[model samples]
Target chain A: MSSKTANPVMRSAAWRISLWATLAFACGTMVVFAFLHRFVASDIRQRTDAWLTGEVEVLGDVAEHTPKDALYDRVVSEVAELASNEVPNRLRSEGHSNDLVFFLQTDAQGALTLWVGAGRGEAYLDAIRRRPFKPDEPQDLPVAGSDAPYRVVALHIDDGSIIYLGLSEHDELRVLRNLRFRFFTWWLLLVMLGFVIVFYTTRRMLSHVREITEAASRIGHTELDKRVPVSARNDEVAHLARTLNHMLDRIENSVRQLHTMTDALAHDLRSPLTAIRGKLEMSLSAAAHGEQAEPIVAAIDELDRLTEFLNTSLDVAEGKADALRLSKSELDLEELLRGMADLYEPSMHEKNLRVRLTARGPVRMLADAALMHRMISNLFDNELKHLPAGCTVEFVLETAQEQAKLTVQDDGPGFSQEILPHLFERRVKGKQSSGHGLGLAFVDAVVRAHGGSVAASNRKDGGARLELVMPRGLAAENAEPRPVIIAIAGSGKP
Target chain B: MRLLLVEDELEIQTLLRNSLQEAGYEVDVAGDARHAEQLAMESAHDILIVDLGLPDRDGISLILSLREMGVSAPVLILSARRSVDDRVKGLEQGGDDYLTKPFAMAELLARLRNLLKRNTPATGEPTRLHVQDLELDLLRREATRSGQTLQLTPQEFVLLEYLCRNAGRVVTRSMILDKVWGMRIQPDTNVVDVHIYRLRGKVDGKGQPPLIRTLRGVGYVLKDR
Candidate 1:
């Protein structure tokens, strides 16, 4: 699961989508809550404004018709009645009970004559006196030591007297605060839900894309017959799998055709070549000695060369068809090369070429022993065929990190610049080369099939150098041996 | 020695018959697997040379059937299917040896002679091998020439033994590599020549007739001449 989430694309996509979705959801919730907050708040303020205005009008009537004493009595009785009725309601609900509407009367002067609410009105009266009030608009009186403000209203009649009415908006403010708190809580929940939904959906969709990527990574020549598994759903990913499967089918068909044609050519061409060579050889043996038999022997030699050329062509074709079957084993590198050097010692001496093998000790590697021998032998063959007399051929073996490296070098005319780049390619032979050019190419194929690599270049000082590097171990360790047997022409047994 | 040769191609059959006859062996030819089986069953031929490709059946099955019929003569299978698996399969089915198509006649004759030598009676046969004054004791794994014991490495001993067995006949480098070294692929180098040169130095010595003579580009022949 960690590996799945570690994919950079999927991780970033999931995070980006979740973050944007949560932000968008939070913004939308804020907008809706802000609108509701304003609507509820305004309605509460309007009701309080209407009730305060009516109290001021009733006080105005008392101040005009009665004397100052009667107005005072009316104000006092009204304050007491409101306090008694508000007590029960405040006790009934645990809300703001600071709704004590205050009434005050002034006798021909803008002075404080009455006070109400929780605190004394001396400070309230001073705040009201200091501020100017418009006759048509209600005034907001700030209570000195509280966080809530009050709505103040005033009324006057023809009695040369003034009346002021004040209503504390603490209850309405508390109601609006509660509404905001509820809205914020719900908005937080919605944002969390948005994040989860977005992340999950994005991750699920991208996982399907990863399946296609993994399938593509496994496609190669050896696995041309394999196809990406398709899901049952008729989705984009399934369609891609189907398309890739169709492509694989086409590739496998072509590979099969190439293999069949190669086998046929091996049979059709080699059989007749065999017959011709046999007859020529018989004639050479039966012919009279000296000049007459020379031509027959020469013809037979040419036929042998032709047969070798055909076999090389078949090897190249087989390489292309992926038919080079390998039987792997744990082989001692020192012994294998020693055998090769021993095999080539005679030819090396014929050219007066000094062959030196430099190896520390036995280097064991998991490889196909026969193929490895042939690969090295082909290299030596190249050295013998191209290098001049008195030149030296060196075989160096060592362990570098986890790989076994073998370098074959010869102090000879290095590869021409024209053929250096295409050295390992089939038929990429040098001008002095008499071979069919499949020697090095076959070597390259054998090395690659063993999961190793081969390279050719010119040495700095002089000489052509070819290097073969193979891993020292296999992924399956020294797993069970395959039952496939490789029968060489005269090899007795393993 | 009488030989039975089975081949579908007329030219190859005719050529092999003439070559074997000239080599001083009586040869009988068969154009197909059926005729070859009939001849092999009726006559006591010293050797059988059968081709894998036949009109009636595969030569491998033919050889297998011959063995099943209690014909114990050494069989050499010839075929165009030179893949290791095919050759191994042919040998696994009771073939004494296998030679691929487009082979050298000399190599074929040498292999046939080797097979025939093995099939001959071993009674009264000395445990030692000799080519003129040179002698190799098979039981003791030692070699001596002119009453002087020569120090020989294991590889050199094997090479000398092969040359002694095929004395007076040419043995190609490939044939020696195959039989002595047990190698199927021939190296581009003249490894056989090098070993033979080493053996000649020890065996021929000073004031000795050269026992092993190079046959130019063909091979080496060991003879007291």
Candidate 2:
């Protein structure tokens, strides 16, 4: 509740998984549709080519055997029987939409002969003449203006006797057309079905990943006890769960280590500190009562040093002891800095160090005021401990043009740049450092909690400066912000 | 001075036992809840230090279960399960104090002594939570966080109590599912969130602090603040 972390703000694993899975499913659906379309079309072409070839062969045989007049006589006689037998009954009984037949040639007077006008009209002959064809010796003429195609063959008799045969390609063309329609319908349904499956599966998978990701993110933000749920079976999701849970184990261990270390420091150091305080109190009382003034004064100074160390040690223990105990609220940073200055002024005066505080308008921030209060106070302690004699300790709190800086500088002896990087490292007591070496460590921890960065260096004018830099709004508000939300995981899976 | 400690880890418990006795507190040690339960039933001790991950039973369950059979002693929970959810869970189950482990013996003693000092009268017959006109009668196991009262199923009341007790801390998705739902549904289901929303709508009516607010980047926090 206290920390403003963006760990859970990014796209969820579930959403990512679903997105990719759905995309893959759509691509596959397209490929299958294309393949199906081409397949049905190719099949129709091959069958039509074969039917046309068959019509030519059958007509060529009749021309080779039967004479022209006999062919005409045969056509005239065969209409009733062919109607009954040659076509499907639906076409036979229904005459207008039926396959038509006819023959045409030059008459004995050299005019065109219209001999065999059995079932067809001139439209049939006109259709025969108009269709495009190659001059193969057994080429068939194409039929026109029907749901299915028809082919015609013209045979020249020996005495210039023109004989012809007409065969309807209605059935084969119908089959091909029907096949294409059916294939389209079936394939369309298949593709839709595939998409639905992909959507559901992807959504489900992504949602699973989302849950794990959320859990992992929670663990990253110091919820060390949180663990990713591992399914009893061993799969990738389960593997991820197991791995995260393993990491959580270490985190919990380290968290426990931190607490134990704090407790140990507090308990271990308390007795020695109490003994020193007791002796100093006794010495001070004895000095007031008797004439041993110098020894009492020396004892009092040593007691001050011991108490200071004890206080710092207790602070280290508290930092680790209840780091999880955070009381968060929305408060302005400007006011908080003022409060810190007021609390630390007496200590600064005791050391004869002038402390300066500055602020403009309100700078709103969400944090645990008590913790932040302690954090800045620790920084002031460090400043007082390391400042040069007669040098004022300046506490500068300023925000200009969107960037906020909090700097604590001392007039005391400053360290070289080499010791700068290690100042914030835990337990690293530098030459000009204060309070058992954890003052900067505690400051670093608090800065990190605010999602800010800390740097310690010598001032351009020969002093020690600890600067904490953060965006005017918590790094979160200043960031290219997005709502911490996502489409639930695995929503896209089939 | 003598304390019966129930913990699974030999190393941690041994360190704790040695540390407690060194700090001048007598300790009766049990590696798991079963042994501790037997020892606790038979003997007398000043206080108890319990670990949740016991071999026989969850330390919380053991404590609550013992309370059912009338074991009236202050219990101090020392666990590695250090979520606010876990802490709230231990307290809800009749634990007097909850301390996440890697704790100093002195702090644990301070907490134990504090519990020893503040002796609350046990609710012998009628154990219930009453806030304002609302009464959650544990004996009858009924409902009421505010004026709108209803008879709840046992499961529902258990869930509500956990949420109500941890009213100001962020409760994780796993916490609700693990403790309340208890591995019934697949972890992937939004049942926890769904049920929480349903419960919230029912409990926090008209206008209120939304008893449960999602913490955006974290879990759900039960805070009116």
**TM-score of every model versus the real structure:** 0.69, 0.50
lDDT of 1 by residue, A232-258 (tens): 889877888899889888878887777
Instruction: Report the number of the highest-DockQ candidate.
Output: 1
* TM-score of chain B in each prediction: 0.83, 0.49
Per-residue alpha-carbon lDDT of candidate 1 for residues B24-51, written as tens digits (9 for 90 to 100): 8899889887898788877888888988
lDDT of 2: 0.57
Task: Judge candidate 2 at residue A201 and give its lDDT.
Answer: 69
Q: What value does the lDDT take at residue A242 in candidate 1?
A: 90
Task: Give the CAPRI rating of model 2.
Answer: incorrect
State the lDDT at A114 in candidate 2: 45
Where is model 2 more than 4 Å wrong at Cα? A1-51, A64-177, A215-243, A288-332, A343-370, A381-416, A427-437, A449-494, B1-225
Which lDDT value does model 2 have at A446? 67
TM-score of chain A of 2: 0.64
